[model samples]
Target: MPRIDWRSDSGSAVAEFSMVAGLLTLLTLAVVQLGLGLLVRNTVLDAAAEGARHAALADSSLPAGEQLTKQLIATAIGEQYAADVSASYGTWHGQPCTQITVTTTLPLIGLIGVQHGLEVTGHAAREVLD
Candidate 1:
């Protein structure tokens, strides 16, 4: 057999490892980012729904619901995500309802993203006295 050239392949393993490691790092970061985005979205949606249910009570008002939503968001994530919260009266399935809307940023790179990139709304039937 002809003499093999080991020197030519000496750094090939390192180069291949570097490329694969970089790709794996990027993939891991992407998965983490996706998870964080989903967590934020679910938290915001839950907060909105809780706020709407609270406002649907007979003694609660739209402003109170908005405040609760803001507080929930601020407590869970940050004050920035609670910046744009609103509550309104509406009808769902012919029944009076309270609606809470939360508009916030969609996290792209570590909680930094385009403004108003995500919007979620929650509703609950209003409580009325006969």
Candidate 2:
């Protein structure tokens, strides 16, 4: 019997690519999703910290305090992403603290909706001045 020539097969490359492409695509999407999640989480944390800092100031107004937190995040992220930001102010350890929570969803074709989605939370605190 003669040895089979694998390279001569017409569908071999297509089949191989089809299998590997799906896995690679999925991996790329996962990485992107993770990066986005981390970025959003950090933004939320920073916003909260800035808000608390403003609130701790001697002459800071409530609306200005809220705007400072929202604006900081809006500058880092764009308007589309900025809309989801929400913050609440409170006291912790005698310090003014702001808890910022940001949430968004990503599309996942293979997983449909479960694994593709993510939720991130962050908190920050600052000492309140008399």
Candidate 3:
């Protein structure tokens, strides 16, 4: 090989590595954020369903269901996520049912996101004494 000029590209590798590393870091963070959002959503949904089932019992009341839902959410994530929980008596498929609704924030960046961005509801058939 004729006169090789190695000095011309001495710092080029560092510059290229920096650019690629930055992009990879951002992509990693985005994936982690998405996973967190999904986890929170699933947790909230499960809590609401459990609450509705509990409230559907003959001896349980709507307020009790709401409290259970709030407690479950607070235990899973944070107290703020447990806010805005409501339970109501309604009809589902023409049968009496207990419904629990949870409205909370959608986590985007480390458990901080748009308020009221996510809403989930759970329903269970009500138990009646013959």
Candidate 4:
């Protein structure tokens, strides 16, 4: 600290600014990624719920629910998210019900991501007539 050469600071400002800008860019991307993930998740969940309700009808079948779920997801998001969709009959709270499940990948980059990144299910009681 005896003698500081001010000339040595040449280009220091630019270097520091570059680093900070990179960090800020990364942070922004992270936030955007999180939002995208949530959006995909919610969309898939809604599709599953719709499928479950459709299948729960007295006249509906499990395959119908699965198809509905896939269609919903395909329409809302894309065909990729609609993959691996399935429907099954089950009992919920001691009542017969239809369950729809969707398995899809998270969007790592614009709806393209790892396989089976997330799985979600929906259930609806069967509509019975007296």
User: Tens-digit lDDT track for model 3 on 2-61?
Assistant: 997876977799999999999999999999999999999999999999999999999989
Q: List all candidate RMSDs to the true structure.
A: 2.7, 5.4, 3.1, 3.2
Best by TM-score: 1
Candidate 4 residues 10-35, lDDT tens each? 77999999999999999999899889
Candidate 4, run of 10 with poorest lDDT: 106-115
Candidate 1 clash pair list: none
The per-model lDDT (C-alpha) reads 0.96, 0.60, 0.96, 0.89
lDDT of model 2 at position 78: 54
Candidate 2 overall lDDT versus native: 0.60
TM-score for each of the candidates? 0.92, 0.61, 0.89, 0.86
Q: Which residue segments of model 4 deviate by more than 4 Å?
A: 1-10
Pitting candidate 2 against candidate 3, the one with the higher TM-score is 3
Number of clashing residue pairs in every model?
A: 0, 0, 0, 0
State the lDDT of candidate 1 residue by residue for 74-102, as single tens digits. 99999999999999999988999999999
Stronger candidate by lDDT (2 vs 3):
3
Please give the RMSD of candidate 3 to the true structure.
Answer: 3.1
